[model samples]
Target: MTVISTGVYPIDKLLNGGIEKDIITSFYGPAASGKTNIAIISSYNISRTGKKVIYIDTEGGFSFERLKQISKEDFDNVMKNILIYKPVSFLEQRKSIFLAYDYIKNNSNSIGLLVIDSISMLYRLEKGDEDVNEVNTELARQLQVFSEINRKYNIPVIVTNQVYSLLDQRDKIGIVGGDLIKYWSKCLIELKVYENGVREAILKRHRYLPEGLSIKFKIINDGIIEYKE
Candidate 1:
């Protein structure tokens, strides 16, 4: 299958050519670890190739200023092809995601990327009020929808997730969506802040990449770049 370039050289090299198409890839990290940056840049890169992108933003982190910084002259055109949906609540998010999936399945020839920036934000917020069984059921349904779309249309699905520290395992962290997210995702990447502005991406789980492998990168004005020693 074909791969979509993330527009970051080191990342592309790490993945052996960039993100693989028709799979669910997730990025999990604490705040300010540059998860959103990678998603935006990858979406922008895919849009640059004359294909459309469906971006579902749950945290209101989609920054036009940042996109302009990365794309410069192509920003306006790129934005045109990127269909963005900002869903405020869990119900709204689910609706938006399914709607996008339906649209893409019908217009499969035009779309190349599907992104959900922080997929678990609204789910986490609503979990307190809802029953545990209901939450898990909803999450499972959502993942099933994503998987179906990916397999049918051959479109890459990239999602960002929040992380919580594991109290017993001090060095380990768990993603918000728990095992369902872990099971559905074919590629799982974890990001950490190394310094003031530098961040590192750890390939925690991938079909090919060994666990514990890491690459250092920084979020610059033009998006993510490989960090230099």
Candidate 2:
């Protein structure tokens, strides 16, 4: 494992000291699951610590509106070290990510973290609303590139993802593409909103932890923090 830090206590615990540098990390769950917020907060941490961060907005992942909510100091720091690239053109979004990767690689001395706000856009680029084989191939290719960047640069990579639920009357709720995802991620965390308004971060799969451990958490003020429900 490479030396990496997630800056969140519980997440750091799972990674055995945050995250290893140069590894592709993933967080997946339903909509408004707090993955994007956490990724932004994580970028803030990297910025504050005197490292450059590259945020790839594959599908317009960031907003000045959210930054406006942060404290003035944090906002200043985020602006100084962070660069956002939204590629909307002939190359497509997946290629935009690769372009950002190239930017980070060329400026390896300046980059400390690479954040792909949500990787699903990579799939959507090829499929164009059709969630079929074409989408799968592009998505897989992007993940492979993600892994390469992780190993080569030793920079921590965080990718957020949207989930598709399988309609089932049975007890289980099916999540699409996750079975393939587990192969590339070192840790997995899922966010689910319960029927009673309590959101639980289910430790569905972690490489070194128990199967069912969970934490009650919330996203507040554009930041990701933990709390007891």
- TM-score winner: 1
Off by over 4 Å in 2: 13-16, 88-91, 128-131, 169-176, 195-197
TM-score for all predictions?
A: 0.97, 0.83
lDDT per residue (tens digit) for residues 97-207 in model 2: 788778877888788888877766555454566657767766677678778878877777887777765666544454445655677776677767665345566666655
- Candidate 2: how many backbone clashes? 2
Q: Give RMSD to native, each candidate.
A: 1.1, 2.9
lDDT by residue for model 1 (65-144), tens? 99999999998899999999999999999999889988986899999889999899999998988997898899889988
On the 0 to 100 scale, the lDDT of residue 182 in model 2 is 72
What lDDT does the true structure give each of the candidates? Answer: 0.88, 0.69
Deviation (Å) of 58 in candidate 2: 2.9
Which 10 residues in a row give candidate 1 its minimum summed lDDT?
Answer: 7-16
Per lDDT, the best of the predicted structures is: 1
lDDT of 1: 0.88
